[model samples]
Structure formats: structure tokens, C-alpha cells
Target: MMKVLLTGGAGYIGSHVAVSLAAAGHDIVCFDNLSNSRAAVIEHVEAITGQPVPLVVGDIRDRDAVRGAITDHGANAVIHFAGLKAVGESVADPMKYYDNNVRGTLSLIEAMVDCDVRTLVFSSSATVYGEPQYLPLDEAHPTAVTNPYGRTKLMIEEMLSDIAAADPAWRIAVLRYFNPVGAHDSGLIGEDPNGVPNNLMPFISRVAAGRLPELAVFGDDYATPDGTGVRDYIHVDDLAEGHVAALDRIRAQDDALSVWNLGTGQGYSVLDMISAFERINNVRVPHRVGPRRPGDVASCYASPDRARDELGWEAKRDLDAMCASTWRFERTAAMRNA
Candidate 1:
């Protein structure tokens, strides 16, 4: 069994990936700073996975700490999910974005090199595609990041490619994820964004939970069926599974440093998502149409053919499942807060 080091393993996606990797029988060692996550998540992850989360509570910027985790755990690979993520927040604090996202990644790579652990699975984003040139964005689409957060993602993708080129010993999986919603089926461990959530699903959840006043339907004048932006929403479980599939590929020596999009290849408009959330929770969400936010695109979804063909991964959960799982998590968030 391989001992895998997962950076940001305490966050939403990393926690899910930790459980997924553990379920696949790989020993997990998580390295995290807990900036946007809670220590309690580790307990809940243990509850869901039926195993303890062996974690190294530290920042990715700390090279010595990263090297220690790699050497101490003998990690065969690292699935990196640690970084600043909010688009608006990134725009406001580009220096923090560069420091943590870009510089921190460089430090991690340095530590990995020193520790002789070359395998990596990076958490890229659809934001790299920026304004979609066309519907169902494929891997070949033109790349442009509209926000600083997206720039960090794009920069890392390029950096990984360069590092792999310099030394083929680096086995990397760059998974450009689409809209990730929903929670684990257990309803115990889920996304708990501290303050205001920048993404769609959590905002909806907060509104449904009565924590927020109303949902701001950004850009209701977009050229879509419902006059709203469209995105390909993928289940967190499927994305987690995709990471496992990527690890399998990396371990099996089939392909290294390959990139794939993790999505369902199905586009859902904002109104469609709201309707589905309402149907699943049996609650009417109060919302108002607002002007298009800066850097907001008209449509952006994924073409999942590459992930299906290459990694043998496909998003199996539908919109209903995504909404249902999110509502379940939302219902318990109050208890978690207290």
C-alpha cells in the first residue's frame, strides 16, 4: 500500500479525497494549515472513512514542514488541494494569492524534490478557461484567467508542466475541476465555509438554511435558456473518485503529468440549479436578479470525454443527487456551528 501525502486534506475537497484514497486502501498523510478549514473536520472524516486522519498541521509555504511530511510518511505521491480560492478575494489581495498559491506551490515542489517524492495530483479549476470560447469546454480550449484566483490556477498548471518536462520523473495529474457541489452521503463531513461563500452551492445552502437574507442571482440577462449563466456541476464524490482514478493511473505507470477535466459534460443554468435545490429541499428560496458581476462569464461547462477515455472516470451523480446531498449538509450546518 502506498502512503500518500495530501496537501489541503483538511479542506472540503481534500477531506473528501483523503477518505477516497483511504477507501482505496492507500495510507494517507494530510498536510494542512487549516486556514479555511476546521480541526473538527478530521474527526468527521474519521467517522466517515472509519479511519484516523494522519495529518501534519502546517502551511504549504513551509518547505521544511512539507519535506518532513514527505520523509516522515514516506509518501509515494501528493494530491495538492491547498491554495487561496475565492475569485473576488484574490482580486482584492493578489499579493496573498501569489504568496500562498504560487510561491507556496514552488516551495512544495522543492520539498518534494528534496524528499524524492515526485508523484503529484494538482487541483486545477475551470477558471483557467475563463470566458468559455464555446459551450462544453474541452482541454484544447484557449486559456485565459479573468481573475487573480484563476491566474494562480493557470500558473500552477504551467508550472507543473514545466517541472515535468524538466524531469520526467515527476508523475503529475492536473485535474481541472468544474463546479463541485454536494456533500458526502454520510451528512457528517461537508463544506463549511467560514463566512460568506463566493461559490453558488454554499450560498444557496446558506439561504435555504435561513442564515442569509436572499440569494443574489448574478447576471440574469445572460444569453441562456433562463437568461442566466450555465455551468457544468459535478458531484464532490465523483471528483473525489476522479482523484483516486488519477492516483491509480499514476501508480500503474500508464500516463504521467497528464491533465483531464472532471465534469459531467452536462450544463445547467442558474435557474435550473435554483429550481432543483428548491425541489430537493421543498423550500422556496428568496432571490433577486442583480447585474452581471465582473469577470463573470455567460457559459462555462466541461467536456468529460478525456477523463472518461483516459482516466476511466465519469461523473455519475446527477443534479438531483447534488442538490439532495447539499441540502442534507445544509440542514446540519447549524448543529456543526454550535
Candidate 2:
């Protein structure tokens, strides 16, 4: 079994990927600071995978600790996912985002180089293709990040590409993910945001649980079928599988750098998602109209052709599955707190 080091394996997407990688027979060591995640995530991952996910509680910025973790775990590859992701917070504190996201990645890459772990699968975002000029954005779309979060992702993509160019031995896979929602099927693990969530599904779940007052529907005046911002909301499980597929592709290649869009090749507006969640969860999500935030796009979806052809990965879960799994997670979270 190949050893893999997951930078943020305790977080939402990272835990799911850790489970997936373990199921595929890979030894994983998660390196995280626990700044945005819970320590109980290890139990959830073990319960799901039926194996312990070795923990290395440390920050990616700690070059010595990161290098030691790689050596101790005997990691042959690194999946970098440790980064601050709140868009609003990034705007409010761009330097914090830059230091944590950009500098963290650079430090991780440097540690990987020191540890001789050249294989890497970076967690990128579709926000790099800001304000889509086209309907279905391909990998060729222009990257114009309007937010600090998006800028961090775009800048890292450039850094990875340049690194690969300099070193021929590095086999890198940059997976530009779409809006990843939902949770694992078992409901043992899912997103556990520290405070009020900034994402759409989490907000909706909170509203259903009475934790939040109401869902603030941001701008129904956008030019779309339902007059709401449309986005490619891929299931978190599918997104996790995409990471596995990317690793598989990276292992097969002798010396090559690859990038693919991880998405379902479909678009759903804010209203569409709310309706789908309501139908699946059987709960009324109270919401109110709100002003449109700046840098908000009308619509953005992935083509997924590159991922299909390159990595042989396709998002299998539908909207219903996404909603059901997410609700299951919410139920579990409520029970745990109780």
C-alpha cells in the first residue's frame, strides 16, 4: 500500500478523502492544526474506514513538523488541503488568507521536497474562473479571481505548475473542485464548521435546525432561469472520489503534471438547491431576500470532460443524494451536541 500524507484530513473534504483513500488501501497520515476542525474527526474517519487514520497534529507552516510527519508516515505523496476558505473572511483579512493559504502551501511543498515526497494532489477551486465568461467553464477558462480566497487558489495553481516545470520528477495533480456539498453516506463524518457557516448548504441546514434565524437569500435579481446564482454543486463524496481518481492517475504517470475539473457538469441555482433540500429533508427553510454581494457571479458550472477523459472520474451522486446525506449529517451533529 502506498503511503499518503493528507494536509487537512480532519476537515470536511479532507476526512472524506482520508476515508476514500483508506478504503482504496492507502496508509494515510493527516497533518492539521485543528484551527478549523475537531479532534473527534479521527474517530469518525476510523469508524467509516474501519481503520485508524494516523494523526499528526501540526500546522503545514511548521516545516520541520511537516517533514517529520512525512518521514514518520513514510508518505510517498501529499494531498494539500490545509487552507482558510471563508470568502467573506478572506475579504476582511486578505493577509490572513494569504499567510495561511498561500504561505502554508509553499511551506508544505518545501517540506515535501525535503522529505522526497514528490507526488502531490492539490485541492483547487472553480472560483479561479471568476465571473465565468462562458456557460460551461473548461480548464481553459480565464482565471480572474475577485476574492482573496479565489486569488489564493489561483496563485497556488501557478506555483504548482512552475514547480512541476522546474522538477521533472514531481508528478502533480491539481483538482479544481466545484461547490462540494453533502456528507458521507454513513453520517459518521461531515462538515463541522466552528461557527456560523458561510456556505449555502450549511446555512440551510442551520436554518432547518433553528440554529440560524433565517437563510439570507443573496440576490434573486441575478439573470438566470430562477433569478439566482447558479453553481455546480457536486456531492462531497463524489468530490472525494475525484481526489482518489486523481491520485490513481498520478501514480500511473511516470513524469507528468495534470489538472482536471472535479464537478458533475451540471448547474443548480440557489433556489434550486433550497427546493431540493426541502424536498429531501422534509423541512421548510425560512429565508429572506438580501442584497447581492459584490463579486457574485450570475452562473458557473464545470464541463467535466477533462476529468472524465483524463482521470476516468465522474460524479455519481445526484441532488437528492446530496440533500439526504447532508440532512443525515445535520441529524448526527444535533445528536452529538445533545
Candidate 3:
């Protein structure tokens, strides 16, 4: 087992990944600024794994803090999840996205190099592919991001590629996630975005739980079978397991940089997801047809062939499983917050 430092480790995806890493017998040091997360998430992780993962309260842009955390923990690898993620927010404030995502990643890389820690698993988004050139986006798809959030991910990918090219010792795995939904089966932790959620699943959950009044079905005029947008929503646990697989692959291979898409080879329309949530949870989700958001696409999913072949990782959970687990967590979170 290796000592790992997870930046933004208390957030939704990071928290789940931490649990998986700890369960896999890795010692973890969770570093985050708590910008979009909470300290309580660490407690949930510890509860799930029965391990007290150390928490470091600092931003990734703080080179000194990041370096200290890595050196102090004797971390040999890093999983980067610290960044601004909302596409709409990034579109409104491009500089914030560049500074937090791009500049912060640069700082993290510098610290890793200084400490001679090269193995890294970066959290990337499929939005880097922009409007899909074709269905079932493969890694070979040309990258042309639309919003500032995606641009930051693309920029970081390019930078990491360059860094790895210069140093053969560096090993980097860029996992481009499609649409990550659902929660752990234990219902102890789940997606808890601050303010209004930007993603579809969480918004649907909130509407079901009565936290939000109604769900906004963005544009039912798309060319999809159901007219609403379609996306490949992978379970959070499956996505976390993929990270564990990636860490193992990076450790065993001599490759400098590897990229994989973490997704199931299937797409579900917006109505499909809403219907699943309502049917599985037996709840009514009031929704209305809204105008399409500027950067919204008709459909997006992943091929998952490369990830399956290379990293021996493929998303296993289905859409019904995703909706069921999310509803479970949504109810639990509501009770806890109450």
C-alpha cells in the first residue's frame, strides 16, 4: 500500500475515492480548502473505512501548504480533485476558473516535482470534448471545450502532457469522467453541492426531497429519442473503484501518461432519469420544460473500451441502480441536515 495525498478529498467524488483508497489499504492524507465541501465528510469517510484519514486545510494554490502536506505525509502519489467545476459559474467568471483550476494545478505539480512524487491520477471531465463529434466519445475525439470550466480541464491536460514528455519518470493518469451520479450503498455520503446544484441528478434529487420546488427539463426539442438530453451517468462508487484501478495501473506501467474515459457505454435521456427516480423512490418530481442552456448538448456518453482494455476498469452499475442509490442518500442527507 502507498501513501496517497488527495487534493479536495472531502468533496463529493473525492470523498468516495478516499473511501475506496482506504479500503484498498492505502494511507491517505486529505487536503482541501473546504470551498465546496465540509469537514464532516472526513468523518463519514472514517466511519465507512474505520480509518482516520488525516485532513489538511489548505488550497492547492498554496504551494507551501501542499508541499508540506505531501512531505509530511510521505505521500508517493496524488489524486487531484481540487478545482471549480460549475460550467455556468465558470462562464460568468472565467478568471476564477483559470486561477483556481489551472493555476492551482500548476502549484500542485510543482510541489509534487519538488518532493519527487510523480504518480498522479487527475480528475478530468468529458466536457473537454465539447459538442461531441460523434456518439460514444472515445479518447481519440478531438477536444474543443465550450465553457471556461472545460477549457481549464483541457489546459491542464495539455500542461500535464508536456510535463510528462519532459520527464519520463513522471506517471500521469487522466480519467475523463462522463456523468458521475449515485451514492455509496451505505448512504453515509453523497453529492452535497453548495447552493444550487449544476448537475442534473442532484437537482432531480432535491426536487424529489422537496428541497427544490421543481426540476428544469432543459430543451425537450433535441434530436434524441425522448427530445431531452441524454447522458451516461455512472455510479459514484464505480467511478471511485476506477481510481483505485488507475492507481494500480500507474504503479505497474512504465508509461509516462495515460488517458481513459470513465463511463458505461450507455446513455439515458433526462426523462428516463426522472422517471427512474420517481418510480424507484415512489416520489413525484414536479418539473417544467425550460429553454436549453447555451452550452447544453443533445447527447453525451463514453466508449469505455480503452479504460476496459488498458486499466482493466469499466463502470458496472446501471441507471436504475444509480437512481436508487441517489434517492437513498438524498433522503438520508435530508434527515441529517434537518
Clashes of each: 0, 0, 0
Give the clashing pairs for model 2. Answer: none
Query: Which residue runs of candidate 2 sit more than 4 Å off their true CA positions?
Result: none
TM-score of each: 0.97, 0.98, 0.98
Worst-scoring 10-residue span by lDDT in model 3: 290-299
lDDT of 2 by residue, 78-119 (tens): 998999988778888899989999999999999998887899
lDDT score, candidate 1, position 138? 94
Worst 10 residues of 1 by lDDT: 247-256
> Candidate 3: TM-score?
0.98
* lDDT agreement with native, every candidate: 0.89, 0.90, 0.93
Candidate 1 lDDT by residue in tens digits, 1-338 = 67889899889999998888889998898889998988888888898888877878999899999999999888878999999998778888899999999999999999999988888999999999998888789999999989899999999999999999889888899999998999999887677787888889989888988889999988888888889989899999999999999988877774558888999999998889999999988987889998887767888899999989988889898899999998888877677667
Alpha-carbon deviation at 159 in model 3, angstroms: 0.3
Worst 10 residues of 2 by lDDT: 288-297
- What are the RMSD figures for all models against the true structure? 1.2, 1.0, 0.9
Off by over 4 Å in 1: none
